[model samples]
Target chain A: MAQRTVLFVLFDQVQSLDVTGPVEVFAGAERHTPGTYRIGTASLDGAPVRTSSGLTVVPDRSLADVPDPDTLVVPGGQGTRSPDPRLTDWLRAHGPHVRRLVSVCTGAALLAGAGLLDGRRATTHWAYCDRLAREYPAVDVDPDPIYVRDGHVATSAGVTSGIDLALALVEEDLGRDTALTIARHLVVFLRRPGNQAQFSAQLAAQTARREPLRELQRWITEHPGADLGVETLAARAGLSPRHFARAFRAETGTTPGRYVDRIRLEHARRLLEDTGDGVEQVSRASGYGTPEGMRRAFVKALGTSPAEYRRRFRPAPAH
Target chain B: MAQRTVLFVLFDQVQSLDVTGPVEVFAGAERHTPGTYRIGTASLDGAPVRTSSGLTVVPDRSLADVPDPDTLVVPGGQGTRSPDPRLTDWLRAHGPHVRRLVSVCTGAALLAGAGLLDGRRATTHWAYCDRLAREYPAVDVDPDPIYVRDGHVATSAGVTSGIDLALALVEEDLGRDTALTIARHLVVFLRRPGNQAQFSAQLAAQTARREPLRELQRWITEHPGADLGVETLAARAGLSPRHFARAFRAETGTTPGRYVDRIRLEHARRLLEDTGDGVEQVSRASGYGTPEGMRRAFVKALGTSPAEYRRRFRPAPAH
Candidate 1:
């Protein structure tokens, strides 16, 4: 019976999908159960703002003209790349006062700038995860899940994941059946759990600058199923293990073990997508000693099991 | 570069997501590969239109003022429930002239009204599939796919399926790698393959108005694996098999066999979602005879396999 008002903060160059995907979801919920949500959109000033996609949106009110709604949604975009300090200040002042605070994509950057996500588990667009972590040391950035809910604050990865998070919020507020009905009408999953690891734009390791290390990189990629311990890799590179480890990290921006893990993960993903091999076979071939090991790695880094990951990422039979 | 112009037709009470989702995808593609597309939105008179969720969108041009774009997109919402005759007339005049024509959600209704979809396989929002078929009997309505592409014309089901369709369109325009990059950035699937059957808003059967048949409905749901032939069910209902079959259709708005199929499918879906049973056991319990039969049903209706459907719809383990 409470918490009915939902407000979306709009801005210049905002990602249109981030704004509309979740807005339509809440609107659909309102249509399904009238009086469930009174939705509105606001911009920093009262003027119309052009979305990143070039669509112009006229807001219901300016942030200064509006009162804090029960739920506040902040959407991200290229605009977040150089956000106006006034906007982040506004978020800082009002974010904690709302019953629920949510961000989509690089909107988390704005939230992080406002310091509202301090000491909270959060996520942003996959490509920006490292930058978000580096820039905001107080926020724990988890890139796995499509969305993360830490107490009253929630942040969704990338753009469309906002729809998933909104559906969850509706499920919490109105109930699961209502959310499911809305999701069915929208033709999206009630949730994508986390995100697919196959689209790991952020995970590709940098090529080593040194020729020997670069050759080592190629060898590691070629033999993902081989023993990739530091000692083995160092011997293969003809360097002492300690020096090889530091040099690899310096050149690749990641440690030898982590680089090997990513190489094995990508190799196995390709096999799953391009081959008909079973999970067990793919695991052994990708250097995962057992299927359980692969499963754990998948769930830890991608919030999905290997089998489910293949099902989602593999092209749908060319139908 | 040969076909870069994409124009979206907008109207009052248009679903903002329908317009924005695809627009964002094309815009993302353009961002990734500059000069890829020149996109615009237009209404009949070039007036600003309010979205179904009350967001105001200012169109870039008027329909009459615009030239025939390479791609034409029509988005649907409450306004399509009683479309302006001029809009349909305009669509009828220009629909065939475009290099590619597309519709999202109930926008297919406008295309059908214009006779543009006549004799072509198309789909719309799931809830309106029956009405679309009944009203435009010439259009081959396939409800199974999230989006159906027939040559240069494409139609999508429901609201968010527009995003999936747009991703497909981008993939067709650019390369798979580019589309995948955009999809990763957006956090949406490159494709949802059609839709999830668990969200079968249109598949739910009408409750029989007759008490005898209503009782039969309950029985069928309670025991999906039971022998549900007309003779067996009729005998239990104290009526002759032939008479009961006729009465069932009149009361339930579907044939006995169809009703039983829905029951078994629903039962199987629930088992897949709620239980830990394997595919083989679930097939038998749902009266599917074999795992292959159940798989066939799932693929035909949901465009997903039983195992994949379970992964998609089940309540994911709490994070």
Candidate 2:
């Protein structure tokens, strides 16, 4: 197999994780399997770039000096909201050389700005998915995916999700065994796809702001355990129960009750994944009346109960 | 409460994930309670240290420049086998200022060599656990722990276990709610403690290496589905069935039949975590006579059945 080279682009205020996570996974792979892949970082300009953490990185190449890349990776950060026009244009110029054009976190915005993501199914950090869709009307924004790959372009959600996408790329370029080895070395399960739900407080907030049931939805997110009747919800939204239900489905793509349940479930999942809270505490905090209630909701929506989900999704603790 | 500062000591060939994974969880606590903690990185010398991935990281300070740190974090690498004398001296000198010293993976080796882990319970990367015990007889090595916090010093099993230790530290310093918030931000559950077994391949390999049992163990790992009766196993090892059973226990610290079952179950677990292969296939591949047999084994050992184990352990799929 030809040795694949990755040209990782770095810049000022870059999110350290967005670049490093994938770099670690791939680097670890190379460490274990010597001479299989070669990766290097480049800056648009030759100077050192300071990341958000204030750590400076000196890239091996300036964009002007970079080798033609087999894979081009663009990592996102707080700076993505107002990216350099020169950098955007550079991305546009360089997009076609790579077999895969991948973006991590809000880096999708840069790609979108460069027109690389136009007409492509893509994702960014969940917090900015809507903005990406709104700003680039041609881009098919999928907020739910951990990462997405369409044709030669790929995009991932948030900082750490890039690791997932990179692992997949490694698996595709090499094989499953290589990917699994890397994942084990990194101590992560292989990455989940973009179709997985991007459930969060922010996503719930977005769902609550749409038409016909905005008031009811807002009330539900705030008071998840409330037993508001359909009639009461409709009256709060100033529509007949029957009409409100139809419009709610049209606008939010889910029933009012089911939508409420989803918000609650999201909260519950967050608690489970993030806390040592027992099933009962998480259930109550998430507006489930009891542990049993939370379990049923989790089983219904995520195809796994809360305890099982926690076991699977819990982040590794740091010392 | 006095704000605690964690200084992660970086060196050439340092494991990137070992440092980054824990730092992420520790830093994330800021989301819940801003200004409560400070995180920084340091090196023995001020120059950038090349991580095991060949990527260079610029530390916040050199040992000479670092303040009196509340916590000192040392992560392991291939370099641990032959550490610089300067780095070891620095660790020895500053070991007194550090209220809590943490070591991840083979970082335990450095601590042990410094005499910091002497007479304390500690662990290193599973592959090196025996070596750690052999070299440092004064240290009580808990090979099964993801991490162990004994007195003021803490050590964790390789790589990802650092995350677990970091979360525990957060919980200790900031309280459960704050730690939970950080875990949520990082999308992980609170720490599961040292009691939870490290789920990796090294343990299986370690278990499969005893005399008289080694050949059968290799066979089991190589052919997970074949049913080998006690008589067959004894014959294969050139011993009478009764004598083989007694010798296997003496040699391996486990009964022969149980050892075989463990190998099969461990293989099933790897399959469950690494593949989308269903329970039946995993069972067949892992040398369980049937899916039901595999399920029973999973239930007995892991407290979860095969399908449920997969749901809880499988890495999320990459898109």
- Which candidate has the top score in DockQ? 1
Indicate the fraction of true inter-chain contacts that candidate 1 also forms. 0.62
Candidate 2: segments with Cα more than 4 A from true spot:
A191-199, A206-229, A235-239, A242-259, A266-304, A310-319, B188-199, B203-232, B235-242, B246-255, B266-296, B299-305, B308-319
User: B235-273 in candidate 1: lDDT tens per residue?
Assistant: 999999999998998897889998888888888888887
After best superposition, candidate 1 residue B113: deviation in angstroms?
A: 0.5
Off by over 4 Å in 1: A193-196, A204-211, A222-227, A250-253, A271-300, A305-311, A315-319, B193-196, B202-211, B222-227, B246-253, B268-300, B305-307, B315-319
Q: Where is model 2 chain A poorest over a 10-residue stretch in terms of lDDT?
A: A192-201
lDDT (tens digit, per residue) of candidate 2 on B1-319? 7778888888888887788777777667754677767888888878888887776778877888988789899999887889998889889989867899999989999998888887888887767888899899998997777778888998888686787688888878887667655554543345432233424555443453566577677776687677667898888899999998887777777776777777777788788777788877777788886898877766666555776556435654444
Q: List model 2 lDDT by residue over A198-253, tens digit each.
A: 23334444464565467667677777656656777888888899998888888876
lDDT of each: 0.86, 0.76
